[model samples]
Target: MLEVTLEILRFFVLALALGLFIHADRSVSYGRRGFLLIKIGFLLILFGVFMEITDQLDIPGWGMVADVHVNFYLAKVVGQLAGSVLLLVGLWFWLPSIRTMDEVQEALDRARSELEEHFVARTRELEAEVDRRCKAEAEGRISDERRRILFENSPIGITHGFVGGRFVERNRAYARMLGYDSPEEMAQAQALAGDTFSHIVDPADVERIVGQARNEDYVKDLIVRMRRKDGEIRWIRLEMAMARDHHGRNYYFYAFALDVTERKERSEALERYKRRLKGIFDSLPVGIFVVDRETHTMAWANPEALRMSGYTLDQMIGLPCREALCGDASFCPWGGIEEGVPCTDESFLTRKDGTRLPVLKNMVSTVVDGRESLVVSLQDISEQKRLEELREDVNRIVTHDLKGPIIGVINGCRLLLLEEESLDAELSEMLHLIENQAEKALQMIGLSLALYKIEAGTFTYEPEPVAVMDVVRETLVNLGGRIEDKRLAVSVLLDGGPDPGLGSPMIPANPLLLETMVANLLLNAVEAAPEGGEVSVGLEQGDPVVLTMVNAGAVPEALRETFFEKYSTGGKPGGTGLGTYSARLAAGAMGGTVELSVSDDEDRTTLRVTLPGA
Candidate 1:
């Protein structure tokens, strides 16, 4: 009974220690360093209890004391080692908080030291200055030297020229701004409207400046053009005030001058660019309309916009964009485009004559009426769309009409290929080539028609349970000649299952469309495979059916990104670039997606199609 009670106490101590350790560092959630250190220290103290229990009780598998080789002595040593490590790691993580506290203490100490020194130095200077000031006042000495030094060293251009005529004194900066070598030369020259001031651009500007300074005793930021010492004209600003004696008799005019050439040029350039942009806006091909962001009502419309909506300048000035072009508000993007977000969409505009016009619309935040607003641009593509539809129509008609003749040609080639045993080797090979080419042409036409259906949004889809291997087999048989020509090793892998439907991968898809996608996949693999390399086709049916094709020949580096994009067939010989593109569209039509990747380093290309599982 005493042993049982001791074992229970040991177990409880170990459990409590583990609980503390688990809750010690909540840094990932909620944590306190001081509490964590204390928890770890307590855990170390209880670890010996676990070591003592190792002799009485054996833990199950996958635990610290579960091993048969781990007895009481080993457990005690391990417990000490692990406890030490845990305690160290916990202390390590807690040091940053201690350092933070210490750093604040150090900063406070330095701040106190600096404040004490500042006070002492200020007190000493005040005491010394008071004594010096008393001595100087008793000696009857005036501080005229400080005033003279400040006047000469001031960065601002200061002058003390007589009110109406000759110059008296000037600073170096004032003389330099006036295109003179020094203050002496400027002071020697007369301050009237002659050689001393030949740099001033206009006599009226001078009159205005003198008038403002004389009447108001102060003038600020009076801009004028002046010639520099190097004969270059530059802009300058003047701020001045008149000085008078105690009797109110004018003595001299004090002024400061600053170089303002760069600021002037930038202002002028911005104004000119704005004017030029305004002119270009009217002539732009795209329709531009500025509207109030809150109301979405057009405040201004450029000429092209007015023409696009078939509205005159006066008519479109204040109309809501919907009322002006769309006749309704349904086509608008939204309240307005927010900053950094542009809205792009295709919408139809209703003309005045009740005809609908297709337009590509773009809207973004822009400034209008001196406030934040929306700028909407519309590009008319109705003619381009009409032409595209017409071209597709022509293609559909041509492919539809040529089907019979093409099938007859294929049948004839197949018939000729059958007589290869009775013909010469060259003749037999030619016949085989004819059959292969004919079959490929038939596949191209069928794919083209299928793609046209996808684009026209009229593709018919009747999905039923389909054995994927059946279509893959048919595609392999159809491409036998091409496969033989390339001498490629091919394999088809299917997952093993008891049920026939599960054994052979099956998907819910249109049989004809599935066959077409498979045909394209097989044909592309055959073309990509090296002359005598290997190709593999794999299928797996589950929640989603995946069909994979891998070829030994690498896909070109240039075509990887646009492998499924239309008209992107560059660098591949005898390639229309439409095969993969059409396959993707066909797969999408059947609720599937086609993904492709190529590894030039491995000399392998892979294509995968995922379809809805049956």
Candidate 2:
């Protein structure tokens, strides 16, 4: 029983091993041939153990099955040997497949991890690109808004259009400038015009401007005449440029415009005035020249100026003023003349022939064409000068012819006076008056010649010591009749006092000139004194003696500047105006000066004479 039990246990152990092998076949993978081989080997081993158990039990049917196999133990041994061989062969085949399975699993795990990492990185990149695109789109919208605002609010007239006449956009200012209510109205009008600029711009101007823009692709500061909706013509200044695409083809045109009608009108008016002025200058009788201040060169010469200079306009245009007009380079009229002030004097002009012509020249500094310039006018004074010389000659001949006759009358009167004892008192007095009057006539003739010589600058000066006090007393006595007629009271003083211990003050002067000066001054004082007015004469004794004569009457305002000029008069009845003139000349000949002062406060006139004393 123990043996049977052990065999049975062996048999059960083998069957259980076979059952575990069959179960593992379902859970694990192996080639079909190898699995079949393993299953057949396990069944054979179980059958061998079952046969051994049956042999051990010695049953009648089991003996018969053993006899048919020839030996039960041998059969069991054979079956076990074959099963072991098949099991070993199956393990040999399936073990390499198991290693291959392990390698495939490791490779699949690595590929999955790599794919996960790549997917994560690509997702981040996609998100950043979306964010960047969103930011760019936002900035583009802002830029478009800014451009719209700028285009609408620009002050100057602005417009955009195709190269052909199709308008794209226009600002409010541009619309208003063209006399439209709004931009839309302007656009509607432009659309209705049917490819025409004649409705807005001058047709002729449009032709030229459009032609130029087409050729040059730009136009700047081009002035065009435009017509408003209300039928007013205006001048517009335009600046336009063409926008080209990347292929160098014109895409569109933009323009800026401003109204300049007032400026254009003013320019036209100025041109007209200049034309009139030039006409007048050409027809003038006197010579007129315009000179540049900085270069001292002639800029323009009128017709008269050209004729006087004996040169054509081309020859005189760029010549120096000193060379062309005055012939003295050192003496330019601009040197002494101030701006806006006129200078008039006598000067000589050198003609092309090298002959000097006398002229009275007037010069004034002024602005011409925005630059400092000088305007000079010259009047020929040759005929006037010749007539003055002729008059002087006649006066000289008359004075010479009258001197001998006047001397004869004075001598005859003197002879009559010498025989006073033979005549009665009345007859003797008459003869004496005749002699005095004749002497006065002779003195008058001599004075006339002396005056002529002084004017000619040919007078000979003979210096001698003269008693100024005695001369003054003699002049007062000579004017006594005039003083009495005017009812004037005359006063004389020496060294500011009534009388001084010193004798008559002496001055080194020509005796005749000294007497004439004193007499003329005193006579003028007497004549100018008002009725019942007073005249005061004061003398100061010094190295330079000063003589002052004051009268109650003041000089006339009109003649104050020319009081001592030759032939100047204040419209006094029978007044020669030569008293002050001759007095000044005689004083100047004796190296002296005569001055006149009018005191408005005291209503008085004072004549002061200063001379060298001996």
Candidate 3:
């Protein structure tokens, strides 16, 4: 074992000596002698590899060539000795003591006396060589000084330190990196600055960086948190290099430091931002699915997507987008997404149980990774569908059952009115009032049915010439009882003359819809107005006809914003909160607009309806 170990060690030393001799030998006096010595060393290494104790070679002169002592072991020892001497003679102009000539002479003489005179002669010949070597060494020193100048002035941070955790040299850039005024200041504050790695906050990190540098003889982009002179911790990426100094024979660790705080901070902040955004995405009620444009497969699914699709997270990942979202659809939106168009519609998503879930989605086509991709935002509309069904049920009951009593009451009134001739004058007047009230109730029931149709989206627009004042007068007559109870004073003004329905003041609309809209607005005005206060209804004739209703009471500030929204209303007797909403729908159906204004200081409210002129 010891013999094998010594052989391996000897092999490395001889190999190193061969390389050094060939590289450093530059003198013309050697004349390829250094290269010849390298070849000899190479042959010895090959011998060691190919030949062992069990291997032997028979030649004309075994281990010797042409009367020369060319034995393998002796050749290896000689190559090492001669290569070292020649290489030293070139670089440092030094000679080794030659005590024997048998190592160099062809006859293999071991006598030192005969070669002593020749060695003396060779020594005299090398006197001039010493002078040349001195000149070369001086030039080398100048070159080294230039290198040192470049190192000091370099912008990149550079530092050199011994293994004992003491910095031997630092450039200006390195000193500035640690927040010192100058390199000298940094040198003086070596103890405070953590010597070699005192600024490294983590001891484990220090060990890692050092170990990495030692093992690899170089380390690049080794990030560490280092403290500055002001005690501010910053991230730095150190490129470390290690080497043995040929002059001192000591190991040195050199580092090129770069301030990576900004880049690292930005990366960390971006990562943090990604985490926060992912949290928000997972918390949303709407589902978001990203699909590959080429394959149309699910690339990413947010948490909401899993919930909305009724699929487990594992099921949703990598599933075909069409299969996961709308597997039952004949025409998939993915096909259209391939054309780079954005599409949105209400559709049904099939769940795991084959139950259809109503959904509304916005699918946009975009390019990603050199291919088309779809980013789908989904909303579950099941609740909206349920509410619509409930509303339809309510409307159905009113249409089929609730109108019977109103018609029966009207028929009873008609029978009593027919016997007016046999009754007294006061009783006849009472019967006439009952008949009018009953007719008004019937009209309200019919209007309710029409509103239901309008809500169901089954009502069609019927445009006809209609008058604002005529509708207003009919509403006042129908609501006469309520008006008298409130004691509200109402006034009507027509700007298009008495026959307002004949010309400019007339608006094109379904007469029934116009009447409903006017009656609701008039009722709101009457109900909001104080007793004995005025409700002025005015009709203006122009390119667009305007009907303005002004009441003596201001709308509540809180209700003003959502006054026209469905199911939005303030405290009022018999208020269903659908009056303004229906009125706005009616005006919209007739290509008109409705606007409300209030003067809180004056306690007044005005609703203006702008309609297309006849």
Candidate 4:
């Protein structure tokens, strides 16, 4: 066992000598201390192998070799050999890697220096760019300041405020226009002036402006009334806009104001002129109408026009003028006038009752609301036409009636002269009759002239105290011949009193007109009654005086409907159809009314005249 141990120790010394030699060569070449570690590691591996071999050989006096197997001994030998070779090869490979590592470190150090220099240059360039931008911004702010100063010095009013209701800026023009001496004075009194400004605006307008400022961020050309320092009101047109600042806050509101008082006054004056024009249109006496050209509809009409056409303005406006009122199918006068056609000739205007009135219309076309329209004026000529016809009839009647009377008078004179020698009492009597009739004919002509005067509204009244009974007796006496011829029985009833003189006969209304109307009514009553029929005349006195004439005759139903209409008579023989009409007109002129009605049984008809009493 000692021998084996001595051999193993000798083998270990040999392996260490070999490793030291290789490591010494590598250290000399590479000049690295790390090569010594490989030499030490090789020595430790050699020592472990040699101890195993010595135990296997069992050298004398060394120790006991404990179960040394052949395979273990061989493993020890092979491990020592492999360790020496690995140490030598490691020296060679590590020397080159160390030199290569030194070169790589040198290159890394150079690259790091270049990267640092480039980074530093890039940082400085960024700082320079930043500085340039900052300077540019500063210069831009200065330019903006100059521009703002120029704008503030101008005549226009400019102002700016913050969203939180603070006036941040205002121009001199704005402050002076609002009656302030300077912008500082206005800003110093911000709280007081703000309250005053809000108060000057209508409450609704203030709320609307505030809401718009908050929500919309802009408002423009809003006209509002503002009060000045002297308590005078003026109109202003306001423009406003909003802006956000760099801090991402909505901080500024800008506004511009212009005075519009003059314009407002002009508008008001124009409105007043329009009202005056409308008044003139409304007050015209003749019927006037205006029609739209496109629609051919009555766009505007005066009250007189509406009354003449028998339609309300609402029913007529926006309605085709002719179709709505006249119902004419062929040529509409209003439409023709609107189309600029001349219609100066006489035309008929139809009423709601389907009655046509003869009218002379004149038309002109003009522009209204930038559209062509027509204005029409109408004058009713029916009464003038009727008067002309009456004049011709009167001439004929007068000529015929006068001619007969003249002829009779001439004939009577001739007969009296020629037949005087052979004249008897009978011939003398006949000639006297002819002269009396001629005198009556002259009186009839005078009566006709009086009637014509009354119809023409030229008759005058002279009221005096007259006894009612005397007036009645006189009227009866005047018609006594006719009464006797008709054999009419007439009676008067003075009800409710023994007359008390009726206070001087009920205030003596126009005696002539009153007596004439009463006489006409009485004569008609007598003519209407059958023989033995009684006609009663009665008088009642109260606050008002009433004279009633009742006759035992039935009023024709058709005549009763239009009892007082002009030219409507009850078909009486020889009736001229003007008695009732003239009677009613005279009664109305005397501040009284005439009314007629028939009994339900159709047995009696009553006519009543009422007048104001003293």
Candidate with top TM-score is: 2
What are the per-model C-alpha RMSD values against the true structure?
Answer: 44.8, 8.1, 25.8, 24.6
Each candidate structure's TM-score, on Cα atoms with residue i matched to residue i, is 0.57, 0.69, 0.51, 0.43
Off by over 4 Å in 3: 1-156, 161-166, 176-179, 189-195, 229-233, 241-254, 259-273, 290-299, 311-355, 360-377, 398-400, 415-434, 454-469, 472-511, 518-614
Ranking, lDDT, top scorer first: 2, 3, 1, 4
Ranking 1 against 3 by lDDT, winner: 3
> Candidate 1 on 1-614: residue-level lDDT in tens?
56646966876876776685566445423225544654665465455555556545544542344444555444455455555666676667765666675777798899999999999999999999999989898665345566577678887777668765555677887778767888877655544535545667788877786677567667788898876657788888888778877888666687777888898899899899988998999889998888777776778888888778787778767667676554355655555457657877677665545576788878888777677777778889989889988988898899888888878887886887787688899987887787777776777788677678787798787788887887887788889998999899988887532223233555788766787789877898888788999988888768688888999977777678678887767556887877787788889999999998888788998998899887
Tens digits of per-residue lDDT, candidate 2, 30-146, equal: 465676677787777777767776676776765375347434754466557777778777777777777776887788788888888888888888888899889988988998888
* Candidate 2 positional error at 422, Å: 6.0
lDDT value, residue 205 of candidate 4: 68
lDDT of each: 0.75, 0.81, 0.75, 0.71
Better of 1 and 4 by TM-score: 1
Between which residue pairs do clashes occur in model 4?
Answer: 1-58, 1-59, 2-58, 2-59, 2-60, 3-59, 4-54, 5-54
How many backbone collisions does model 2 have?
0
Q: Pick the candidate with the highest lDDT.
A: 2
Q: Indicate the residue-level lDDT of 401 in model 1.
A: 87
